[model samples]
Target: MRVEQQPGFVLHARPYRETSLLVECLTRDHGRIGVVARGVRNERARLQRAQLEPFQRLELDLLLKGELATLRGAEPSGAVMRLTGDAGLAGLYLNELVVRLTGRQDPNPDLFAHYERTLRRMAGGEPLAWTLRRFERDMLDALGYALQLDIDANSGEPLDPSIRYVYDPESGASPGRPGDPHGLRGADLLALAEDRSPDVAGLSSLRRMMRQVIAFHLGGGELRAWRVLR
Candidate 1:
């Protein structure tokens, strides 16, 4: 299939053969895809190679045949996102999540939009913890693992903010044993569920909870980006 000027972002790229690159991209309509960028590593293709970096929106021309699409051309489509320090690491984490969780050619417009918005927000200096947690929630939902936040898994009742709950990765939240230090506050869980502004403590709670959920869904393998961001 031939695609023209497909809007996308490079999620990862590695050297292929002598002068080519194997690029993974997330596109608006095509989800995650692998493409072969032939000869982009050569000195003459420096300009084209530069356009394949992460966090920059691009218009890609592709020729899809077998397993890999041929990257016919690429051009920046918007202002390049220049994130630094922790923000930069967060951006990388986002890319890694997309690469690992999304299936090739499975179109998810909402996920794509969430990813773009999160990157933009991170680049604009939004609080990292909140921004990343929101994206993680959206990403999980898009992938069909929506968090069960409103009800207690054990009792099947709405959450009580004053109570503490133990979250089971597959079963959701249930009331915790009294004074269990590891239990997360129902208030913080509710805040995350409602997308309300969470205080520092709430943000911390949500972060730990999200990490557990994401890691569980990833089948126990920790994300390299998460390790780096720590």
Candidate 2:
């Protein structure tokens, strides 16, 4: 197969054998891909060393054969935003989420653009909570699991901002049920879905709600970076 260049971001990478790496990348045109970079651990392997850092933009050349491709060439297309402090941790969290949720060999250009924009925003020191919430919502939507926030899932009517509601992972938002596992105030839910800054209390409650939703979808595996943030 011929080698072809694709713009991508390194989502995850781990040392392979003695000198190579097994890398997972998210690309604009090709979505997620797995490639093996031979001899990337060598100090003299300049090209491989430079292109393997997470969050950096890269132009990668890979063989088009097999499910796992062989890396032919890689170069930095541009500098990546350097996130620090809480923002940095949040960036890692986002990367982990993408790695978990996105499928290999699937094209999701719109999600890729969102990921790029989100990285820039996080690097600029936006509130990590808000940034993560937005990204989670968008990623779910892109993956076809969009939550129904604008209307009641059971009643089929517009959400009543004045009334409390509960988010059921399987059925979306509905009026608060007495024995539900998780619930949120209508105002907080509305504010979160609308990307508005709710009060601290509301924001805290919304985080819990979103977390339950995310965890349910993730099949109960804890997010390691979130633990760091907490």
> Which candidate number has the best lDDT?
1
Q: Roughly what TM-score does model 1 have, to 2 decimal places?
A: 0.96
Error of 1 at 195 (Å): 0.7
In model 1, residue pairs whose N, Cα or C atoms come closer than 3 Å (at least 3 residues apart or on different chains), thus clashing, are none
How high is each candidate's TM-score? 0.96, 0.91
**Residue 65 accuracy (lDDT) in model 1:** 83
lDDT per residue (tens digit) for residues 116-194 in model 1: 9999999899899999999999999998999998799988999999998988889999999997766888998888899
Local lDDT at 98 for model 1: 88
CA shift at 74, candidate 1, in angstroms?
0.8
lDDT of candidate 2 over 68-173, digit per residue (tens): 8888888888666888777777878888888887779899988898898889888887777777777877888888888777788988888888777888879878
Q: Please report, as a residue range, the 10-residue window in candidate 1 with the lowest summed lDDT.
A: 43-52
Each model's C-alpha lDDT? 0.89, 0.81
lDDT score, candidate 1, position 31: 85
